[model samples]
Target: MNATNAPDTVFETQRPRLFALAYRLLGSRSEAEDVVQDAWLRWHQTDRAAVRDPEAWLVTATTRLGIDRLRAVRSERIAYPGPWLPEPLTVDESPGPEHRSELAEQVSIAFLAVLERLGPEERAAFLLKEAFDYDYDQIAELLDRTEANCRQMVHRARERLQSGRPRFEVEPARHRELLERFMHAAQRGDRGAITGLLDANARLVSDGGGKARAVIRPLLGGERIARLYWAVARRNGYSDWRMGTLNGEPAVLGYTDGVLTSATVAVSDGEHILELLTLRNPDKLPIPH
Candidate 1:
């Protein structure tokens, strides 16, 4: 078949799946869209007749483009204002018949945040194995590593994830309820209520990026965090803080003088909040005009 005759049909059929893969890898939808567009360009440049597995070819093209862009953008990420959270996913339009339930827990904000802790190669290895369900051989080929090494990387990444012990199985509705209650307590300066909602070992990590005044160190323990919240509420209570959905999960966004100042997303385990992530680095906020 001539390249012009049928590749368009093939591209259209495969584009959505490629997008889902790219988004999960890149953590930024806009960047994923760009990478996919670049992949199409490469696809068009190649001799369609020479290609054996179009899907595999597309995946390789997309992954390489994403990795390249990630390397190029690392400097900008480091300089990002306040706490740099992944771009909030406004909608979950993952392509195809895979239900949200079928998607792995790694797609959650908390999970992605943990993925950010790994080195680039480790992150790539883990995503290819866990999220895409690719075998070690395929992951090695995609990442240009030996199969044994790739397996080791995946094992190490999995160990880190396990150590975090995140509860990705929590229902969104129940999680939202807990977050709302916590936000209300914080807003009202109810130290007792807030303390009750936090785990004894809960920690609050604020990303103020030196622009906004935030607790630099991770605030540990339920009692300490509760007291911190009380002090903050007493001082900044006048600010308009609201509980809302962020990245399809429960979050808190605060505004001062009609300008967005900071936001927080908490990871909970049934009974209490385990990790409280505050993004106050002004550079990190995707301010809407």
Candidate 2:
């Protein structure tokens, strides 16, 4: 398409990619959408004649805006009332084999949680490089750094992330099955029944953004968390629990009275659930009226 090709069309073409990048960088859906909107406004105001590749131009703009937003959010997270978790991306996405192959391993709650440890620059560099398939030269150009500097940032980010996660694989099917059983027990207020599905050192993290009922601290030990789930069910009755794909992984999507209320994702070792992440914050959810 020529420079005069409908600008809105061009922008819409890139919106999904841009939104995904921003969401990964900042871990907030609303913040990411704001960044994408800002990028759109800039695109609208910029000189189209001067822009050769609109995709590249828009990507650079969106990524930079995301970086800035991430910095601000990181500071805000410091004063957050409790442990923060990424806003769950609930999509009824049925990826083709290729999409699944590309993202199945990396896009998970555990992976996103590790990203929170990275500095803003390091995280941006790493995400742009790995997820978007940007080259070092392009990353350097976007960040206004030397190629060597971008490479170093990527290296540091990779090192930090890899230092913790083992080089082993876990089956997504196993994790999905475990969550089904776990949620089933919880829905029945049968807390002890699901104990066998958990790792002995399993952990439960609840993020309610201080606007909902969430544990102020992460619940450690399988028994304690199971009891918590049971108690919630007993008190509130069974939520409309369903399974949905979130960040390329199978997770339990819980709704109350036909509105999305909660989400839970599990990190398993192909055996038992090692970590369960529950996001109950209405702010982070897409609640239907």
Candidate 3:
């Protein structure tokens, strides 16, 4: 590559990691892309030769940008219609080998929902330390806080996320199997069969953004969730459905005349689903190829 293009090559390599960090922080692919594009602009204008660690510089820039974006969008999310959900992303969208352990579960829609409880700084600190496996000192630098402060932020974030987290991890195969079973049962309008695959405390949350048809409030309890899906079936809603992966988990995508309609992601504990997130908002259904 020519000298003029060296910076572009370098920035492109770090793009995936940067986008992943941004997505985790903002929970919106479009917002993450905006942050990444901004990062690229800054990187291009920086003194590349003087920069010792390009990755570190880009990561820090991306994290700070993500934190800022999260803070800015907080109020908008609060005023959003119904329950707001993290924008669903395709599994192949930005999967990078550099992500820390349990990347899939960390990026799952359910986990992102739990993260909504954390403040912007706490979310950044916790994700940098836990999800991305950065050192406390590094997290502190990234968030412009002291190491001790960063630790406390991570601690608080962890405590808040713990209560809403799934009790146990489920293998991908088992997760997919359970989702398939649930889909079949829901299609058949077999309320009993559907409830049997859900935990007693199972909850269903959908985001229609007030522009589509969806439950205005969260539906709690296995029986209630099963009944809702059964009703949808009776209305011929699940007539055309396909299994796919979204937010690193098994998901069912509903379509009409080959147009994507709804995408439902299931969070299971090996045997039963603990939470179900369905995105019926047409504005949020774009799957990255």
Candidate 4:
């Protein structure tokens, strides 16, 4: 292996895993890319011969970078006008340690919501252990903490996560069907039908970023959320919805007369949706094809 080519080859090989680690930590593609780039710069400058564990070195670099970036952003988010949702990442499949279907589930809008609530260290510790399957010892070394401390952090993250996460998983086909039912009722403003399709504890969170007409806080309960849906359809006359995939899950790419205005994803527990996420922030929404 030549001097220059070796580093590029090594960085490229681990890029996806590094990016995944950053993305899950920061929850922003742009920021994650920046973090990965920073890791590359450091890797390129480091003494490669002395680094016995390239992946370990890269993982540590990427994760610590993520935690730093996350801490900086957490302050910015405090000033954000309303509740902030992670930028919806579209992934057909993530090439990482987790199983494809399971990974997809973990990246769902709802799951990310739970992760967003966690502190930076807690998030790092949890994702390393749960999603990436890093052993506690490895995680402790990565985070510069003791193994027992990392284990405790992961346990607390799990407890906090479980309280807000969905209880069951739905297959892709069933997920699509649920989105269809949601679209049908939402378009027609059928409160009763919407109620039947929503869990008793269903919650709706809209992110307009203060640039669009959206609720600034979470709307809780099935009946109340159904009413809000009715109000939206009535005002916008959006009786039609286009089916699409967001983050590899069935989602509603809502349109007003063929003009894309909103994108929505739901997290369901087999029987009904447990949480719904609507993104109306144009800047936050994905670019059109």
Candidate 5:
């Protein structure tokens, strides 16, 4: 196809994949949409004839833009009001089942929370290599680093990921069961039952952004975590919290006056809850109820 006609066709063919890549890397649907729009503008202004592989070119463009924005945003993150979770996506259009599943896995609360620990370059390198399956050479080109350096970044990121969690998948049904029990125990002020559902070293992290009451530091251990939940429930009283899937994983949504005020996603091992992440910052609740 000629340069004039090729850009339009190429854009339509590649937009979805590019958006997916950007969203997984950045962990915000709105930011990902912005990145895609910026990529399209850059593509439109480029001399298409000079590009041999349009898809590869677009991918490189999008990744670089996302990386740049992430670097600029990282400094501001330290000053962010509360536990900064990635913005939740509210899918208006129905994508196919496979696409939906893939998006969920990539943008899950657990996955995005982990990504926050990496440096911007490391995140870009790892996302490009792991999620996109880009080779060392391609990744090197994307990050403007040597192939050896790119490989090392990916290696470090993989090691961190493996060392952090068990390889167990918490089924949705079982997750719901555990969450219900945990919530019931908290509401009833039954500390024993609440602690029973938690791992010995369970952690509770709350991101109320300093606006609502949340533990600034992660509360560790089953006893401590259970006590914290009970205290919060007692102090605030249980709003009408509904159980639902946040990113295809079990979650609890706290609502007041029919508006979702906050939501919690629990990461569990087979027997106990490992982590409880509550997203109460109004900024992070952009996901539609």
Candidate 6:
């Protein structure tokens, strides 16, 4: 390696992990990308030689920046016109630590939505320890908190997130099968078929980001969601349904006249779909014009 280029090389090595941390913390793909870029800038400006541990330095900088970004966006999220779902991210064949381990579940829409309940500092602490596998001491150092405090944060976060997160993991094949069934049922406007596939307490959350048409609030109950799907099929109609993976789980994208309309993914138990998260905001969809 070129001696002068060592710093850049080192930062590049840690970039993927840094990005994974930011994305989980912020939820929005664009916002997470922005935070990572900002972290790079700070790394470039700092005195590299003086930093004894580059990884530790970078992690601290990234966590602080992510916490600040979360605090900054709190009000904007509250005033959001409708429900604010995480921007859909298409996990591809990218070489990164995020693709390995159980990281996918940590980044899922359902999990991230549950994380929204945490305070910025608390969220950072929990994610550092839980998602990234940082030791309690490392997390405490990264967040400038006591070890006991970091433990408390993770414990509190887990408790708060428990009710919203799935208790059991569904097999990948089963998850894909359920998504396929939902797509076919929705397209056919078969209310009974859709209802039968849903759990007793299923809910549907739609996010349009106030840029397009979407529900003002989440629809609760299996029957109500099934009815809404039926109504949507009857009135607007759907074409070119594409099934794929988003955030490491099965998702289906609906398009009309070759223009993307909505992207939906489900949170399922082994037996039933607990919730459906649909992103209709064109700006947030992962597509190129």
Best by TM-score: 6
TM-score of each candidate structure, all chains considered together: 0.79, 0.87, 0.90, 0.90, 0.88, 0.92
Candidate 4 has an lDDT of: 0.82
Q: Candidate 4's residue-wise lDDT over 106-204, tens digit each?
A: 676667767988999999999999889999989999999999999899999999998887566567677667877888899988888999999888989
For model 2, how does the per-residue alpha-carbon lDDT over 89-188 read when each residue is reduced to its tens digit?
6544332222233344656667888799898889989999999899999999999999999999999999999974646686656667777888788888
Error of 5 at 76 (Å): 1.2
Off by over 4 Å in 5: 1-9, 91-100, 287-289
Worst 10 residues of 1 by lDDT: 91-100
**Model 1 / residue 275 / CA error / Å:** 0.8
In angstroms, what RMSD does candidate 5 have relative to the true structure? Answer: 3.4
> How would you encode candidate 3's per-residue C-alpha lDDT over 29-116 as one tens digit per residue?
8999999999999998888999999999999999988989999999999899999999866633232323223555668888888899
lDDT of 5 by residue, 1-289 (tens): 9756877889989999898888877877778999999999999999887999899999999999988878777777778765677767752222122323555666778788788878878988999888888899989887789999998999899888776655888665676688878877777777889999999998877887777767777778999987876787788776577666566556677777877777787788768988888888776676453
Question: Candidate 1, clashing residue pairs?
Answer: 81-281, 81-283, 81-284, 82-281
Candidate 4 regions off by >4 Å? Answer: 91-103, 256-259
**TM-score head-to-head 1 vs 3, winner:** 3
Error of 5 at 77 (Å): 1.2
| Pairs of residues at least 3 apart in sequence or in different chains that clash in candidate 2 | none
Per-prediction tally of clashes: 4, 0, 0, 0, 0, 0
| Alpha carbon lDDT at 120, candidate 4 | 100
Better of 4 and 5 by lDDT: 4
lDDT of each: 0.75, 0.81, 0.85, 0.82, 0.78, 0.83
* CA shift of 47, model 1, Å: 2.4
The superposed Cα distance between candidate 5 and the true structure at residue 280, in angstroms, equals 0.8
Top-down TM-score ranking: 6, 4, 3, 5, 2, 1
The residue pairs in collision within model 6 are none
Worst 10 residues of 2 by lDDT: 93-102
lDDT of 1 by residue, 209-252 (tens): 77788886677899999999899889867557776545545567
